[model samples]
Target: MIRHILLIKFLATADTAQIKHLQTLFEAMPQKVTGVLTVEWGVNNSPEYRNKGYTHSVLMTFADEAGRQNYLPHPEHLALKQVLRPLLDDIIVFDFQL
Candidate 1:
């Protein structure tokens, strides 16, 4: 299995509505993409306070690397990026085998 994790920091201009939309869109990915085993996301709520301003995270489980590769260029993924790119300050993606 593969775990695809994304951490995001929103730009100042990003509003509550946009963040909610992003959350909803990301949570729906397992249904839209064939190889997506699971999709989960949430606002940062850790008390550790070491996040350096990153405020949201999305974790996706895939059957394998090929599944993740398929998802990267999928049209649905591209559409989501179009909506999110403008509002993003910074983002980090980490992938690993499980």
Candidate 2:
């Protein structure tokens, strides 16, 4: 399996409603993408407070690189990015075989 991890820092102006909307859009991805095996997301809860501004984390599992590749430009994913990209201050992504 391929584990894809994402960390996001929202812009200060994002506001609660916008963030919630983004989360809702993200939650809908599994239904839109057949290659997605699992999708889990939440606020960063580390006590260390050393996240460097990243406020949320999303973990997704895919069957392999091909599945991940298919997801990258999938229409639903692209549409979600159009909404999310502008609201983000920074984003970190890491993918690995598991």
Please provide, for model 2 over 1-98, each residue's C-alpha lDDT reduced to its tens digit, 9 standing for 90 to 100.
Answer: 89999999999999999888888888887788877888888998899999999999989998888889889999999998999998999999999998
**Weakest ten-residue segment in model 1 by summed lDDT:** 34-43
Go through the candidates in order and give the clash count of each. Answer: 0, 0
TM-scores of all candidate predictions against the true structure? 0.95, 0.94
> What is the TM-score (0 to 1) of candidate 1?
0.95
* Cα lDDT for residue 58, candidate 2: 87
Per-residue C-alpha lDDT of model 1 across residues 1-98, encoded as one tens digit per residue: 99999999999999999999988888889899878899898889999999999999999999988888999999989999998999999999999999
What are the lDDT scores of the predictions, listed in order?
A: 0.92, 0.90
Candidate 1 deviant stretches above 4 angstroms: none
Clashing pairs in 2: none
Which residue runs of candidate 2 sit more than 4 Å off their true CA positions? Answer: none
